[model samples]
Target: MKAIVKSARGKGAELQRVPVPDCGPQEVLIQVKATSICGTDVHIYEWDEWSQSRVNPPYIFGHEFSGIVVEKGNLVQNVEIGDHVSAETHIVCGHCPQCMTGNAHICQNTEIIGVDRDGCFAEYVVLPSENLWKNDPSLPWDEASVQEPMGNAVHTVLAGDVVGKTVAIIGCGPIGLMAAAVAKAAGASRVFAFDLNDYRLELARKMGATDIINSLNADPLHIVKQETGGAGVDVVCEMSGHPAAMNQGFKMVTNGGRISILSLPVRPVEIDVTNDIVFKGITVQGITGRRMFQTWQQTAGLLQSGQVDVKQMITHHFPLEEFDKGFQLMLEGNCGKVILHP
Candidate 1:
């Protein structure tokens, strides 16, 4: 098996021959057909402070993937061989308080597949049976590889009811674009998307955003207020993770509106809670990962029904041997979610 392996910090990943892994008693062996490069993978490659603290060296890097089950362990009775599948990257302990209460997405004891352990950037990968999800045969492997991130979009938008409400997304990245489509499909009256990059904002427009805001020039708050008749938007999805964008998102929400945050900010920044959140009576919710099987079911249904245009989010594809090129594309911000074939 050939895998792109990160042997040390601040080093380029190399394609090396490695032994294939066998399945555990409760796991299944999947032959990876397609995988996508995520922002976290770029962070790991750059050996940033966050990745230095979170990721140990010599780990296979990738989490968003779709493949076929080649073999199943004896204890894995739900899934079978030859089934098309994707997986929940977060492996949770079912005994935790959050898991017992049916909120496994935020389980206290969680190990992410690529970050904490080996991931799906290789010819074959092993996953716990509980994390594997069966995919509809009508979908292609390239499209299925996006389910993990698409699930993030679904969880963010579905955190609150968006039907007949005006919604705004503060970022036009891959996940943000997905959120735009999901919000429109879920019956949002108007979808506004904001970003610094004009290219991404264009993509957001194609994804069903009724209005696009280039924050570099126009004032997003004023534009959103004017678009909504000064009432502001009913829902604000903050996906930029930038301090300024986060602050603006809080201010863009209407009174009693809901704000769902899906971005992971790197540093602690001060916010004007008095005017932005407290005085406005806004409902703020922090979103992390997916909602376990619930998010998967909703995302799968949307994809199967062709309600969400996920294929538009995939702008580049590369072979496994060209992993470095794919990472460079992401670092340069030249494309959308880049897919890799192993």
Candidate 2:
């Protein structure tokens, strides 16, 4: 099968033919239909500090995808051949404390596909049947492929109630854009989207942001303050990993509001705990991956029901051989969700 392999410890990947993997007794073999480029894939492509320390080279490295079950191992029971599906990226130990108590998304021994094993940037990939998420047969392949990341947006935005309240999304990346849409669909009175790039901010507007503010041009805190009559926003979804923007998120949320953070900053971020958190009496949540199948269920409902349409946000597509083009757009921050057909 043709696959995009990270052949060396460097800044690029190579398209090469590799042997198709065999399905284990508990795993299933999927024929890749469509896959999406993620920020983590960009980190791996750039060989950044996080990728260098986490991923070993010479492996397939993409996790977001939709595929069809072509073959299944003898013990696989959750799905059958010919099922359309996406997957939960995190593979966890079901016996751990987190897993046992229904918090498997944070299992101590979690193994993420693409990071810990060969990923879906190929014609064929194998995964545990337990991780498979059945997709509606009529769902578009590209849209279905993005459920994993959309799950992240759903988990972050819905961490607290947004209904009838003002919410601020502190980034305009793909997930941030989705958060704007989710907040709007969840009945937020106003959705303020912030980002440095106009291209993404425009996309955020398309995704249902009531107001778009380019943080580079206008002060997000000031604009939000004026818009909200000095009360600030009721809910803040912190998707920008930048320390400065994160601090802005802390400052712009109203007293007794909620702040849910999903971005992973490279370095330690400094915050004014006394004034921004304690005195304001806000609820701060550190969001990780989706809340297991619950977030997945909500994400699927939003997409399937047309309540949160994502078609406008998926701005680009490329063939698997042209993986570099997708990565380039992601690096430049000029595109939304980029899907790759295998």
**Top of the candidates by lDDT:** 2
* Candidate 1 error regions (>4 Å): none
Task: After superposing candidate 2 on the true structure, give the runs of residues whose Cα lies further than 4 Å from its correct spot.
Answer: none
Task: Give the worst 10-residue stretch by lDDT in candidate 2.
Answer: 213-222
Per-residue alpha-carbon lDDT of candidate 2 for residues 1-342, written as tens digits (9 for 90 to 100): 999999999899999999999999999999999999988899899998888889998999999999999999999999989999999999999999999999999999999999989999999999999999999999999999999999999999999888999999998889999999999999999999999999999999989999999888998888988999999999999998999999999999999999999998877899999999999999999998999899999999999899999899899999999999999999999999999999
Cα lDDT of model 1 by residue, 147-228, tens digit = 9999999999999999999999998888999999999999999999999988888889989999998999999988987888
TM-score of each: 0.98, 0.99
lDDT of each: 0.91, 0.94
